[model samples]
Target: MRVLVQRVRSASVTVDGEVVGEIRPATQGLLALVGVTHEDDATKARRMAEKLWQLRILDDERSASDVSAPILVVSQFTLYANTDKGRRPSWNAAAPGPVAEPLVTEFTDALTALGATVQTGVFGADMQVHLVNDGPVTVLLEL
Candidate 1:
């Protein structure tokens, strides 16, 4: 499992012109782009959530856990794009929807269990994500 974490002041995910989830935080929050691959399981998903919540990339080096930040989660299988060969990227490394969707849920569930307010995008849907980045901070966590 991989999570691309970005610190943001506010973020939202829209699907089919309808806003599905959003968070406009007073302080910095996170937009978590999650990807699942073969061999990834619930444990890895949970671990990834823990790491994301504890990551110290927010203002003054404070973690999301320290400030009770909100999180906007989005499924992003393209994170596994393999471009080692030709121009067209290969999705072979990404887990199929059937195998990935539940794990992504596990990740979100884990984050909620950790006491963070969370929002999410529709899985497998064409989404438009909007955000105002904070400090332009971005981090990737793979487990």
Candidate 2:
């Protein structure tokens, strides 16, 4: 599992002109782009969720757990793209949809269980996402 976590002032996702999920935080929060690989499982998802909740990248070095911040979770298999051999990128490292979708859901569910307000983009959808990045802070975690 790999996750790209961005601190954001607000974020939202829309599909076919309809808002699917959004997070309008009164304070700084996070936008989590989740990715799953063949080796990833529920345990990795849970661990990633815990790390995202406690990551201290927000203002004043406060964590999302510390400030009750929200998180917008979006599926992004592209995080595993391989561009080493040719001009075209290879997606062989990314897990297939059927294998990945459930793990992504587990990650979100774990975050919610940890008392974090979680928003999500529809899996496998062509989504349009908008976000106001706070401090332009971003972190990538791989497990």
Candidate 3:
């Protein structure tokens, strides 16, 4: 599993011209772009959620758990793109939707279980994500 975490003032995801999910924090929140690989499982997803909740990249080095910051989670298999080939990027590293979708859900549910207010984009749907990054802070975690 891999997560691209960004500190944002606010973030929202739209699907089919409808707002599917959003996190409008007064000052800070997190946008988590989650990806799953063939080897990833529920355990890894839970671990990733725990890491995201405790990640201290917000203002004044505070964590989401510390300030009750909301989180926007989106499924992004593109995170595993293998572009080593010349023309086109290979998608072999990314897990297929059938396998990934459930784990992504697990990750989100785990985050919610941790007492974090969470929002999500429709899995496998065409989504448009918009956000105002805070400090443009971003971190990538692979485990």
Candidate 4:
């Protein structure tokens, strides 16, 4: 499993012109673009979620786990896109929807289980996401 964690002042996802999920301002939060591969399992998914919670990227040098910040999770299989040898990116490293959807759900659930106020984008849906990146702070988490 892989997570691209971005600190955001606010974030939201829209599907078919309807807002599906959002995190309001005045609260510190992480926007997580999560990905999964065929070899990924629940254990690794849980570990990555735990790391995101414990990551000390917020002000006051506090981890999200310390303050229970909210999280916005979006399924992003493109994280595994490979463009090494061809003009077109290869998605071979990404798991198929049947294999990936459950892991995505698991990752989000793991974060929620860790006490995060977790929001999520619809899996396999065409989504428009908006965000105000705080400090432009971003981290890639893997396990």
lDDT of each: 0.95, 0.94, 0.96, 0.91
Q: Report clash pairs, candidate 2.
A: none
C-alpha root-mean-square deviation, candidate 4? 0.9
Off by over 4 Å in 4: none
- Stretches off by above 4 angstroms in model 1 are none
Give candidates' CA RMSD values in order. Answer: 0.6, 0.7, 0.6, 0.9
Clashing pairs in 1: none
lDDT (tens digit, per residue) of candidate 2 on 8-112: 999999999999899999988899999999999999999999999999998888999999999999999999999999799899999999999999999999999
Cand. 4 TM to true fold: 0.96
Model 4, range 12-77, lDDT digits (tens) per residue? 999999999999847688899999999998888888888889999998888888877789999999
lDDT of 3 by residue, 1-143 (tens): 99999999999999989999999999899999999999999999999999999999988999999999999999999999998979898989999999999999999999999999999999999999999999989999889
Q: What's the lDDT for candidate 1?
A: 0.95
Clashing pairs in 4: none
TM-scores of all candidate predictions against the true structure: 0.98, 0.98, 0.98, 0.96
* Candidate with better TM-score, 1 vs 2: 1
Clashes of 4: 0
Tens-digit lDDT string for candidate 1 (1-143): 88899999999999999999999999889999999999999999999989998999998889999999999999999999999998999999999999999999999999999999999999999999999988888888888
Identify the superior model by lDDT, candidate 3 or candidate 4: 3
| C-alpha positional error of residue 31 in candidate 3 after TM-score superposition, expressed in Å | 0.4
